[model samples]
Target: MGRIALAELSKYLLDGHLSRRGCLGARRVVTRPVAAGWMLPRAGPVRAFHAAPGSTTTATASQGPAVPLRKQLKDKAKQAKKQGKKKSKADSQTVDGWELTVGIEIHAQLNTSRKLFSSATTSFNEEPNSHVALFDVAMPGSQPLLQQETLLPAIRAALSLNCDIQRVSRFDRKHYFWWDQPSGYQITQYYEPFAKNGHITLYARDGISPEDGESVTVGIKQVQLEQDTAKTLVQTGNTHWLDFNRVGVPLIEIITDPDIHHPRTAAVFVRKMQLLLNTVDTCVSGMETGGLRADVNVSVRKTDDPVRKLGTRTEIKNLSTIKAVEDAIIAERGRQIRELETGGVIVGETRGWTLGSKETRRLRGKEGEVDYRYMPDPDIAPLVIGDDLVKHLQNSLAVLPDAELDRLISEFGLTPKDALSLITLDNGARVQYFYRVLDSIHEQVQAEFAASTPPDLKSYSTLVGNWIIHELGRVTTYKAGPLASGELSFTADGECAQVSGSDLSQLLYHLYRKHITGKVAKELLLAAYLDELEGGVLEAIETNDLWFKEISPEEYSVLADKAMAGEEKVLQEFADYIKFPQGKLMYLVGKMMRLGPTERIDPAAAENVMRARVEGIRAP
Candidate 1:
């Protein structure tokens, strides 16, 4: 009976004369595909497709008119079948399955001080109701006002996504029920969003080359400006609490097409978006507590023509971690596949993934929102952005994260991995301190070898990348923790804002000259960074006795002699090791100096003397 109704609905939509406005409107009716078998009740002249029960097949494209309606119906079926195949293919890449279509709606909280429609404070973690204004809470007689700061970021993100920013955009009501929502409807862009028809480049992990990495493109549908709803806190005793702190906060919703195929790629897309937003300072640095959240819609279908076995789409909600997102996508794909293979159909529903269990449970129906009944919010007027305003914003909008990542690679000579890591850690502030420190390091090294300039970037880029990602990472994380011992301190907001690049450059130089091997150089750098995190008086490791204490010069020489005296089998590699280039020799020195057995002397000095002995042998 359900299949018959769906086939009739598909026939009606195809046969009906839908006006352009009706076709384009947000309220267009959506009907699921009819499964094989079960004919519809004859009403008027509409014809429907039907097959015998247990046939496992239905009508094909060759038998029908290629009208938009027919194509949509046929496409839905094809999509469903492809979805079923997606599972086996995932487990074994060679398996044939449906292609997965993923659409992302990224909700980025704006970096602003006031709410969109009210004068309430937009600060995070304030007393729940303190930031709420009567107007924000939708109290009687309060009116909505506009906030320019909120709109600009949306426009910027739209531009970044290559979207067409509409000059006049208005808000509408999205009705829903939740304790956190003081108003029954959320004011959001629907009829016409702030931006439209944009795309972003997403690099799937597979797309990256082992030799040189690059990303592929993903299409974006639009970027819209919306007001955020209040948050609900699930209390301990099966009760829920409301917090209006987030009410009226400006938000930008970026919607993308189902171009993504893999969960990791989706995560990469999110990360890239976060980087772009943060670097431009358009949105709150995402992934921070209460900064941003995302909901993902994923569907799968087979590749056969007029495909009739389109797998169901599942909405995965509130996935905060990238890893979790990938896992959920994989798990959901598996769940759907297993059901289909067992002769059970996959249902289209909204689901939530619990990271702990790695399983997704159905939460609600997707078709329920077919009647969201959105209407214009007449209280607020449309935003009219002028050409002058757009120009100013286009110019003032900070450099994008992609360009920054590329620049970090070219200027600093970083590997794709290293550049990506630093950009990820630094966010939009990638330039403010990190690059400055790197540049200072380059300059100081050049000055140290004023008579002989430092080697070109290729030699040092990896070192710099490793130093920042590993050494500095430890410092940043530790300073935010309790054991941080340096002068600088992590602010309550958990940022190391006061630290400087020149400070890092000087500290590293000091480490290099103190006869600290590359191994020890990282240690000393981290130690000084610890001081920076504490927000106290700036001090170096030498001042604090944090440098690795060294053996006397005479003691080191005796140890070197002992190492060469016996164990010819073990000692054989050392002779050739000393003969290798400086780069290879440095690696040996690093191994010797690390807290490993074999040598008690400092590796750097031992390296210098070993080279001399090797040269003596070659001279003979």
Candidate 2:
């Protein structure tokens, strides 16, 4: 009876879906395939999720709703910087000798210009049901035509995660009744998924983490392609509204084994997955907008039980953010333990992470595989890939985050902490910016040195990295919006800035050749990033009289003599050998630095000369 009613509704939609009386809109929606399925949007005003159909509203994309998830994150970061991570309720907490275990199933919408089975378009903020096609409406006899373009990201994800791709894969029908699902059934891979048996290791670079080292490898059970359902908007008086725009969109579901032993570790694993997927252009950053989400499976077991049997697990569905995942697991772990201690058995059920109360609310009893009535998708045929296609995908895949972390540390001579910072920020935009500047410098040096005397690029690594990371990044770019969108249109200083690698290279080139002091280099870098310098760093140096004058060894010795004469008390302290500190040496160097052209002196060389002079002093 349910199947008959769903078929009738499909036929009803197919009759005159976009006519004058259609539920979507009065006019047809025109979508250019080139402009379909939003890319990583630049930070601006974006309407995240909609409310009841009437009162229209919007929000700042970086900051979510009233509480503003990103703001909370920024505040947490500040607290962490000062106080360090305090033990939270979720930090490897055990109750009566019981341990918690969690696994995750992530469904990330693939970044594509069109739907998985039809030419219909996909988008973030399109009108309701406007992007719908015949297949999306689930009209009877509408054969599923596989969109070859949709498979690219799926293949890329599997290969990047080290999954074994199945050349021959088939689809299955997952039957369920929901107001949002127009077809009453979803087409997904189940019997033989496209990929399986992979692992993503967390903290792969820095073992400084006291958590699992390489042992924190989250085993990926399978990767399967599936179709997304429609969006249902709830209104006042229990009114329900359906939007078919998301119907039939393609998604690749990655399932992980129950290997995660800590809540924080699970959170890190999800965040790492988001970075990796976004880096490969899978477009999974839409946690707020439903472009990406996860369902976590949580269970607890007695540590002292010799058998070490697993407890009954409950599913926490639809966690959209990293914090939510960690918090939900922590809450559920406590809940399960409490229920068992009170002489109550843990029941298998589907639960929701309530945002308002910050607890997991029981939604319904868990549905078994038999309840879903899984069957072969008769309309869709087995998906097969040629050997050539698989080989090409592997060769052309984007470099994963872990691999890039290793490369930066080994090839570029960056510290592990610095390397991880670069790759994680702005979805690797800092890393990209770093390389762009490096390329400019390398090109500049190639012609200066012969092939036999190829300049040691590694020698300049520290200098280049310091200017980029410290001056340009921390001072300006990161302040623009560190935790939010990395590609902030305007910098924090309210300057519409676009500083190129060549501009930085020019500034560093002068600093490298000792034509400018480090202080002057920093000023140039700051000016360039903010676009305050009109004619670039070179012209600014020329116009502002910022060039450094080389102080001869004899000149340094004279400056040291002046430094000692002015700092009588500090010199006395140095003479007494009591309270003789490194700062006293720097204090004398600072005196000399201010005497002559401050911008022209290298304080380092002056410090060396001043140290020698101070060594010859006596208490008398």
Candidate 3:
């Protein structure tokens, strides 16, 4: 007997001449069948054993049963097919007993006129390369100069997130090689970020009662100020062009702890953050335009794990929208679970989500701290914050979302849901418009109160909120340009309605006073779209022929006689209740309303006129 190669044994096993159990020298060789093929033990070379022709005995001293070649091949192929079928099933990837953990990183571009480290303009959607400055392009002699305006927004954002703002911070250069980065590095806060150890409380989705809704508090790890890189436009093939207009733009990266367990929770948190940032005028928070983006890190551990050690995490980068963030997290979690189930190790890497494919693809291996080689920049000095400056920044901060929401609820008497809805409207200008309308209404109410006629603030606030959130908000296709120009316009679905806050206030005032019907007010609103209310709601109503004429008792007598002509039952009913108008008030009002000058006439006034006419007709 000579030394036998494993390949030769595998060939013999495939050919049905050798059994799985065979003896070789001092060790016994065993081969187990696998899905793809066969599994063999790792050992040294072994002596060969030859089988007798048409016999189940080996040529050596050992004897074993032989399997037919065709049968063995068929069985192996069938097993492989079964394995493939199992892999194709989604149940094979089920991690029903695993606990999922997620963390998010949000990069929100600050709303500033100038770049973070340069005087270059930070306006978006501008002509390519036109807004780029010498410093933005990283010229040899150009040095970084920190923008003071950038700090205001960052500090406001930190306060909104309830984070601790550091009095002193320094800029560090994060070295990385990328064509989109002209400086070959990014200036960011590494050693000490501006804010840290904050938390955001997010409630469940809409329609869930506050008592029943569970609130999740996600911890904020840190909020750091950094400069944005230039935009990279990918062309045909491997060609990529860079636009430096966005280079050096200010950004605040908000990192969160691994407290998120559900996808919807992450979405709610992102939306809340966006609203808070937009409310403070920190960032536009537009995902489509790249004003805000998210990076989600997901990992899973066995639900039964006693030690509770976390599994490997995969970072999904640059999720541009809240929905994208949710989708990417769910898909990545499933991928990791499936890989683990298949006896495959989950790799720690940076992956990109292809929204079209709805799958995560590997971008690159994860980078460690040493990869960045962070160090304080020599050109820029450390930032020193005095108490006076901090107080100034704090005083300069506008009413944040939470404070405003509370005010709207407590002072204005708006419901919690209504207040939340008003503040979280997608357009920040709309939210501003809501407050302006509320203030104008308040002023009017105060004046009326001074005149000894106080109005219900709660009812008025509810009416205004409903009008803005439901009626005005429903004009989705309307032009939003006028809002940016300090006016509101609704020009879509064949309706063009544009009016300023004052014009709308006047219309609401007339309606509240019962001077005009809701129909007339709506018509006036539509008329205000094309022209400003020159003489206020009255002029608009008169111009549009929406005014209602008040009929006197003598005039209503003539009209009511005509309306009751040949209708003896209606006339008798009116005559029967002539002295007590309350009995037939509704009937008489309906008859008089038909004969009124316009539909905008007050129904109560019509009823009164009808009662006076009926009484005069039935006088003893």
Candidate 4:
């Protein structure tokens, strides 16, 4: 009885004769004048009932349109199934029944003149092991001494991340047997680290959709000072050697909480941190040269679990690039999910990311705290970071990336995207070069407009940014090739060997004032880059005779008259366009340009003069 009434109600709804609310609330429903149905509210469930066929009230099939009830139900079911399939496909990339969590550990080498425990020079690409001191090799009777110069960069890094600096931090010995560490232990801040409880805010890069402009804060577990180990070099076959030159180099390890979920977030966090460290001049932030590296911790867990407890994690060590970090996490997360699906447990272990295969392979079983015996180092004294020192470091802190980005936008009138591109450039020297050129341009303009309306700085900044980033940046790529191939060696200090910021500034000023055309500017830049410009930009323009000459309107009128005198064909062309007022004037201007010699003439002034001459002749 309930099925029959429900069937009748579906038919009414399909025919557009029943409102949803009325159908649900009506105690009795009548499809026809004489037919009746009733809804029964039971203890367990509410049911619908239809009147018997032979009862007092009944309806014939002719009362409504001839539509089959079975077909209606089947169609509704099919539509629902299609919608469900679409939603499921959209979510298919997500780990089935699981969520991902990631944490990162970054090791940034400190920029210092000497090593942390020795006076050996901290230089790269030097003769192998030549920079190693006696103490670096753990010589007998040699003791570890802290480098005071390393403290400022560390303090600045901590403050930049908004970490709480501990006034007194102690060093500890982390004991382990390894070929790289001759001393069989490392000196690091374990029990009392320098800073804790810090965080960095990140934004998605341009391509991402949902979180493109969104902010995500990743927590900093700790930032501690430690010594770097020697690099192990594997020779042919099984023989390996160690280079002690890198040993004892100062390092700051920033450990992050398990706050990252998406692989892109992990990559973005690393990039932001790298930019911050570079801005502070703490490190070069070159992953390829081993100046910075990251260890990523990835895990997965049930998605719907309320507790959101983390599953057992696997650590992928020494991921050297941002792409490597992101790819490693994504690959590891998928691996763990697949393992769980196959009734395999995720083992707690350490792994290495193979760049060639883009997979994580087991390195060793993960070590617990007990595996590495930790104790306070009796030789080195505890570091006491007084308020005076913290205050001094804070004052010395450079403008960080985010703050500089904001300043570039607000003070210089640059768009957010352009400002970010300038500040986050890989080479710090290029960023410095941009500002230097910008300042030079502003100074020249200011001097020129001492007592007049100031030049539009917004326009100047945009112009400078475009030329520097797009033009100069493109021309400077030759240095990346072999120097023996005749490529100019562009120094990392932002100084081009053949051209300087002052020279570029002079050229830009000319371009801004319309003293030179864009084609002439490019020619001058290329000439300057190739060291062909002997006495600088002015001399180059004079020597090449590429300067643009601005003509007075009266002078341009005389020139136009001389060109139209004996040229009959040109006269006929001008007379043919006399019906259109300005056409003849435009023709005269083109003739003037074609007749001009040596230097390029100002087209605007010539156009005005030609129009005045044509109007005077037609006035009578």
TM-score of each: 0.69, 0.77, 0.68, 0.71
Candidate 4 or 3, higher lDDT: 4
Question: Model 1: how far is 244 from its true place, Å?
Answer: 2.1
**In model 2, which regions exceed 4 Å deviation?**
1-86, 89-96, 204-209, 284-289, 354-358, 446-456, 474-497, 530-532, 562-588, 591-597, 611-620
Per-residue alpha-carbon lDDT of model 4 for 370-484, expressed as tens digits?
Answer: 8889999999999988899898888888888877777877888877787778776645566677788889999999999999998789878877878776677656666323322
User: Per-prediction count of colliding residue pairs?
Assistant: 31, 0, 1, 0
> For residues 281-314, could you state the per-residue lDDT of candidate 1 as single tens digits?
7787576565777888877666565557545777
Best by lDDT: 4
Query: CA lDDT of 107 in candidate 3?
Result: 96
Q: Residue by residue across 1-620, what tens digits does model 3's lDDT show?
A: 55667876676565433433434434543332222233221222222333234333123212233444567677889989998898634332334688778899999999888899888887767788889888888889998888888888888888788887787888899999999888899999888887889998776433222332567788999999999998998899899888889899999999999987766677667877888888778986578778999999989888887688889998999988877876787788888888988999988999999775667999999986799999999999888656676677677877777677778779777787887887766445556677677788789889878968676787787777777776554333353334324434432211124567777777777777666777777656655654656687767677766655555666766766665566667556655563564655566678657766766457766666666666665536
Can you tell me which runs of candidate 3 are displaced by over 4 Å? 1-96, 133-135, 204-212, 413-417, 446-453, 474-497, 532-535, 542-620
What is the alpha-carbon RMSD of candidate 4 to the true structure?
18.0
Root-mean-square deviation (CA) per prediction: 20.4, 19.3, 19.4, 18.0
Model 2 per-residue lDDT tens digits across residues 491-563: 2222224567678887777777688888777767656655577888888888888888787898887777877
Q: Clashes in candidate 1: how many?
A: 31
In the predicted model 3, the residue pairs found to clash are 498-529
